[model samples]
Target: MILRQFLHREPVAASYLFGCGGNASAAVVDPVGDIAPYMEAARATGMRILYVIDTHIHADHISAGRALAEASGADYVLFEDAEADFPFRRVKDGEVLELGNVTATVIHTPGHTPEHLSLLVTDHTRSTEPWFVLTGHTLMVGDLGRTELASSAEDGARALFASAQRLKQLPDHIEVLPGAYSGSVCGRSLSGKPTSTIGFERRFNKAFRIEDEEQFVA
Candidate 1:
C-alpha cells in the first residue's frame, strides 16, 4: 500500500490519498480545495481514483470531494446517514472498500457530526491487523473534535464519549491520521503534529483519556 497526506496550511486541514500500489487503485479522503492536486497525485502514482470520500459534511471550508470525484470519474462516498441532497455511494458501518491488497473498513463514529465516520485501513500484504485510521474530525493528535457542531453540545458529547470508547478498542499501535491539527477550530488543545498513534493519544490526550461517559461529557 502507498499513502500520501495533503496538509492545507490556509484551511488547517489534512486530506489523504492512498491505496494498493500494485493494483494501481486509490481513494481520497476529506479533500479540501483544488481538485488538481488529487488528480495530479493519482496520475503521478499511476493509480486510478476509485473512491472520493468525505468523513462527514463540513461546516468549515467548502469541500472539493464531489468535484474531485467528477473529475476523476470516481464514486463520491459518504456515510449512509449523511444529510446531503446530492447522490453518493453510501457506506455503512462495518462495510469494507477493497483496493486490491489494501482495504478500508468503515467505522461509524458520530460525535463531531451526526454522520461522521472513520476509516480503519489494513494492508493484507503486511498483516490482517489495521495499520492506521483516518479519523476525520473524531480524533486528532492531542484532542478529540469539539462537540456542538451539528447538535446540542450535551447530546454530541454523549455520542462522542461512546465513539471514543469504540476507538479505544483498537490496537494501541495503530496510527491516527486526523483531519485537522492545532490551528483548526474543530479541536481545542490540538497538537501541531498531524499524526499520532492510538497509544500516544490515549496516554497524553486529556479528553480522550476520560473513561467515564459523565466525566467525558462534562
Candidate 2:
C-alpha cells in the first residue's frame, strides 16, 4: 500500500492520496486548491486516480474535488445524504470502496455538517484491521470542528459529541488525519501538528473528555 499526505499552510487544510501500489490504483480525500498536485502524486506512483472524495461541504476554502475527478476521469464520491447541485457517487454509511489491497470504509459523522463523513482505511495485506481514519473536520488534532457553520452551535455540538462516540469505538492505534488544523476557523484550539492518534486525542483532547451530552452541547 502507498499513502501520502499533502499538508497546506494558508488554510491549514490537509489532503490524502493512497492506494495499493501493486494494483496501481489510488484515491484522494478532501482535495483543496488545484488538481495538479494530486495528478502529480498519482503519476509519480504510476497509479490511476480512481476516486476523489470530500468529507463534507466545506465552509472555508473552495474544494477542488470535483475538478480533480473530472481532470482524472475518476469517480467523485460523497456521503449519500449530501445535498449537492452536481452529480456524484454517493456512498452510504459503512459502504466500503475496495481498492485492491486497500479499502476505505465510509463512516457518517455528522456535526460540522449534516452529511459529513469520516473514512476508516484498512490495509488488507497487513491486517484486515483499520489502519487510520480520515476525520475531515469532525475530529482535529487538539479540538473538534465547529458546528455553527450550517446549524446552531448547540445542535452542531450535540451532533459532534455523538460523532465522537462513534470514533471512540475504533481501536486506539488508528491514526487520525483531519482536514483543518491550526490557523483555520473551522476548529478552535486546533494543533499545528499534521496528525494524531486516537489514543492521544482521547486521553488529552478536552473535547473528547466531555461525555455528557448536554455539557458537550454547551
lDDT of 1 by residue, 107-128 (tens): 9999999999999999999999
> Looking at model 2, which ten-residue stretch has the lowest summed lDDT?
3-12
lDDT of 2 by residue, 1-218 (tens): 89989998766699999999999889999999978999999999989999999999898888899999999999999999888999999999999998889999999999999899999999999998999999999999999999988888888888889999999998899999999888988888999897999999999999986788988887
Candidate 1, residue 15: how far the Cα is off, in Å: 0.2
Worst 10 residues of 1 by lDDT: 55-64
Pairs of residues at least 3 apart in sequence or in different chains that clash in candidate 1: none
lDDT for position 4 in model 2: 89
- Using lDDT as the measure, the top candidate is 1
Model 2 ranges with Cα > 4 A deviation? none
What TM-score should be assigned to candidate 1?
A: 0.99
Displacement of residue 185 (Cα, Å) in model 2 is: 0.8
